[model samples]
Target chain A: MERDDIIEYSLHAHHSAEEGVKIRKKIYFVTALLSIITIVEVVVGVFISRSANEFANPGLWTSIKIGYIALTLIKAGYIVLVFMHLGEERKHFKWMILAPYIMFLLYLIFIALYEAVAVGHGMTL
Target chain B: MSGEASKTIESKVLWGGKVSPFSISYGKMMMWIFLVSDALTFGGLLVALGFARHAAVTAGEFWPSSEQVFTHFPFTHAHLPLLYVAFMTFILIISSVTMVLAVEAGHRMDKKKVAFWLALTVVGGLIFLGSQVWEWSTFIAGPDGDITTWADNATLKQNFFLPTGEMVDGAAKLGQEGPHAYAMFFFFITGFHGFHVFTGVLFNFIILMNVLGGTYEKRGHYEMVEKVGLYWHFIDLVWVFVFTFYYLV
Candidate 1:
């Protein structure tokens, strides 16, 4: 009976066999897969920065900045959605966690860029 | 249904028993409440960062360029921008990973492994805090032989010229230089976050001692680690925004 109990505990812990196995494996696989996407973010950021430095033009520079922002947003979104398990949650829960944040972040970004750009009112781009 | 009611009554009595008065687990609930408060703290910091940026302290004169302020010795001394911040970001991400592993070990009830990972997380926190100190010192450069402080990029841009000619009145002529309110905000926000990390490491150290001494062994589970892990993760989450707004953005 002791040997049987040990086997049952091992299986339950390792597979979560008592709860189920497929969901656990899926979470594990998804986490490993998303790690590749994170590596892509670093690589893309470096590439954009390198190219911007090489060309050293205003238009190219703006594009590089956009790319950086977009890539960062992607990485952040993925981490929140997957690692934090916000994606698997109910829709209302998702909005409860993210909506206010989106609104607040937008407000901050608007203020930052607006003030930054408005610094020199009469100066030409 | 009757059996369920009896179990509920038993649980209520058990929870109300002496030596542990909480209905729910005290540690886990406290962690949640702490995280809620911490979220507000971070939100306020970000809002303050926005306010400072909106104040336009530099304006057209200096424009407060991050690239200029952060030039350092990592790649080359001539002029490297934002690289140090990127390194700091990497340090934080790695620390968060170690923290997750520590929590994982705790879940597995591996006391020694939990202690080892917690120590790693503490060391990572210390290293990151040390890097911030170095970053700050480099930012506030020393006076030269002629008593002229180094002209940072912000000053140069504010001057609207490459070479900042001279000081107007113990201040650089190139830009609207000198410490401002925004500087105060930066120091306060970063200092507060660093203090959290420092205190967090101390808290984890206490838990480590307790675990090592078999206090947790008698307690029947490693719930303390789970409680502290929540705080540590919240700290890491706040750093994510700090890196973006304060450094990258």
Candidate 2:
């Protein structure tokens, strides 16, 4: 069967050995970054919860949550860019993938802030 | 050469006729799009969680803080906070790395390495699924009790021991009506993610079989592996946010 449908990018693309090395290094770097971030988050969270005691003072929670989410977003960006190879993608394509998520994140942050303020006023939105 | 020809075509008209504007294949682009929508779905769930938590917190009702509950490790009775969940996060992250390695091997047309890395990925996914199972059982079993006086005592006693090392209100009410939404959202979000891991393992297994059978070798490419890799990475990415909202924050 002389079928010719698989017009993929350079089917037998045997990239240079150095290129493979670079890719592997990037993967390791991202892994290390993610691991460190997770550990830092846990340690900081547990320490603050015990020391400041968010249970006693809920005011600190909003600030703590902001830091946690920021770190988590950084880990997520590395996963998408390096592991998923979205960074290697075309310029416009990168934005195409990211813009929607960015907008959703803004909306989420807005809601979170609003809730924090509203709860203080004894209101639910 | 095709490269020279495409360079001219790219500059002339990216969206006209044959060239893919995004410079990605249909399947890969579709996978990316699907993942975006899936991310939104998860975002909606977390938003709902936030809404419930606020309502609960404002009412002075019981809301289980992450530091309070989820202290059980697989073995040993040390009151560790966020330790087990941190391990789970580590496992998922490692699996995502292996998946990237597999995809890289595919890029270089190295079938053997692809299979090897994919096998590791499948094992990692299985471990995560098993960990979730243990976690859920501990959650559902509640705290041990005779359950003679109270009907919902066992379930209620799930709040038996928090990491705070103190029980509020002394054997009754425990800060008003218990943490219902906390437990509910825990189940829904983690269960949904566990299901994704289960399916991911199944999918990776199928793809691994193809790799072993030399299907990709015959096809002269392994784009299928790359596509699966994208899905695997997406799962790990979702877990980061899940771990943040549920465990860390």
Candidate 3:
């Protein structure tokens, strides 16, 4: 019996050579994008550390930190959407998978920040 | 059976008992559910880390910076901040790409290509795991040279010395202080992430074996690769969060 005769499910759509090339291109694009973001993050990190008294300006440091977080989130989003094949999923399915997590993450962050501040204050007193 | 009763049953049991409400395969949907729960577990750990760091900082104690703690790279005594971690992150992201490629190949029923990409993905995972091991060892052993303080009782503290042999601030003690708290959280958070990476590597190896054995070929679909790919990407995604929360922040 042929190897192809026993299989039952079609998890992926049929693709042509052009589609294959497109997929490979997408993979390269994702890799390059993630690498660039990482480089930017490292450069920013090293730069801020090397600069004399950069931390003295709390505002500037906070902004840089926020930028670092934003970049990381972007990289993660790209990885999930493209590499994880979430982007190709149906709209409702994507929402079903993502919405609850996003809401919960926000809630957790709020609770953590609030409680941490309270703990900090209590420790000081 | 009456026509009305039969129609009602058919409507309720969609897709001939497959019952995929979201139109995804059972395996893929289950994988997504598992990933979501795993993500929440990571989230809880990270949030705890955040709270711990916040408490330490608010207490006006000395918190050891990430650069100070993670400066050592493999085979080099130089102090390169974030470089090794950056390499680890790149390796993981690249492995994600390779896993996607394997899925793509599977879509085409190209067994050879699928196996090749899966092998590369496994290699990438192994390299990442090895790097983590090296990192964990360096963390546990800490920097050389002990600094002693003469208090009521003489205590020996391991100071993290720079390549130039200069000790960082607040490096001498490790009991309920800022730096100590920082070290504890660092160990816990990164250790947890490293555990996931280890498991992911193991999972990739299992899937790779299946690929090489032509199990997928026999099954006529590479859905297994895609399922594992989802898991592998989740690991990379969690690392992105860990890298940000622990290292960059």
Candidate 4:
């Protein structure tokens, strides 16, 4: 009975074939999509820099920043999902690993943006 | 089943079902855990780099536009955007493929094939390292004329201070900012990654020799292939992150 119970729990915890295949497909699709988006981001970052137009002024930089973040998130998502095998992991394990990271990242971002904005305001003065 | 056989089975089952320091081979499981920790370190560095970029850009420092900085041919003064990084990316990817092939050969117990594939992977790694060296030299040299040196190795201060106590402008100034902390980060990160590649090549070489000596053959299956493959793939995965964060971003 003890051995049977152990086997049952492990079988549940162990990575399954059906899930692996699905995750693999998802990874492939995400990689292709991310590659396309990366190309677009590089082109826009480079080409738009040369322009002296109004849309190129504040808007171009803003767009580039947003694009960079979006692309990074997609790449990170794929890395975690596929290479790290998080996609097929137990929901509790996933949360345990990533939740702290997500929280800390957001906190760091807030502090950085706040400092940067303050510095910019000071520079203006 | 016979009583002795049944007893033997019970003993096996009892021990096998439990997770113990001895039951789980510490070496292999530790490798996985170490790899995961290394991944987190890389992730954190990249995140910190992201934060730096965000803060600096918002603070009115003209981000060295990636296109303009990277645009260069060996001899001719021509601007080629995304060409160098793309070439480097392709080289790393090809090396990754060769690494996979080496792993396959190891699985088949083909020592010669594994050695050959691993050697190619090493060559590819060397080429990538050479390319990185050139990139770093160009970055530190600071254009054709201006000699900008960072005052101190401080992260807070922009390293590129002019002789006139001003930030180096676009035009080739007489005394420019020496390489800043950004350049330092670039060198350290890429240099560290290159060192991993170098060491990985050595690991493959050792494995090749072991295989030639009939070590794994005597032991049974080629599980070493799986172990090394994990390292090889981890290297490739790191490159993917580096290529994204360092170049495109």
Q: Which residue pairs clash within candidate 3?
A: none
lDDT of 2: 0.77
Candidate topping DockQ: 3
lDDT of 2 at A69: 79
lDDT of 3 by residue, B1-249 (tens): 743233332232234454445556667878999999999999898888888878766765445557545776777777687888989988998888889988899888898998899899889988998888777656655433122322221111232333344333333344322355666777777788778878877887898898889898887678888888898899899889988877777
Which candidate would rank higher by lDDT, 1 or 3? 3
Q: Give the winner by TM-score: 1 or 4.
A: 1
lDDT of 4 at B57: 52
- Reference interface contacts recovered per candidate: 0.03, 0.49, 0.60, 0.10
TM-score for each model:
0.65, 0.85, 0.85, 0.65
- Binned by DockQ into CAPRI classes (incorrect, acceptable, medium, high), candidate 1 is incorrect
lDDT of 3 at A65: 79
Residue B71's C-alpha lDDT in candidate 3? Answer: 73
Winner by DockQ between candidate 4 and candidate 1: 4
Displacement of the residue A17 alpha carbon in candidate 4, Å: 17
Clashing pairs in 4: B148-B176, B148-B177, B148-B178, B149-B177, B149-B178, B160-B177
lDDT of 4: 0.57
The runs of at least 3 residues in candidate 4 whose Cα sits more than 4 Å from the true structure, single-residue gaps closed, are A1-65, A68-125, B1-28, B104-113, B142-179
How many backbone clashes does every candidate have?
3, 0, 0, 6
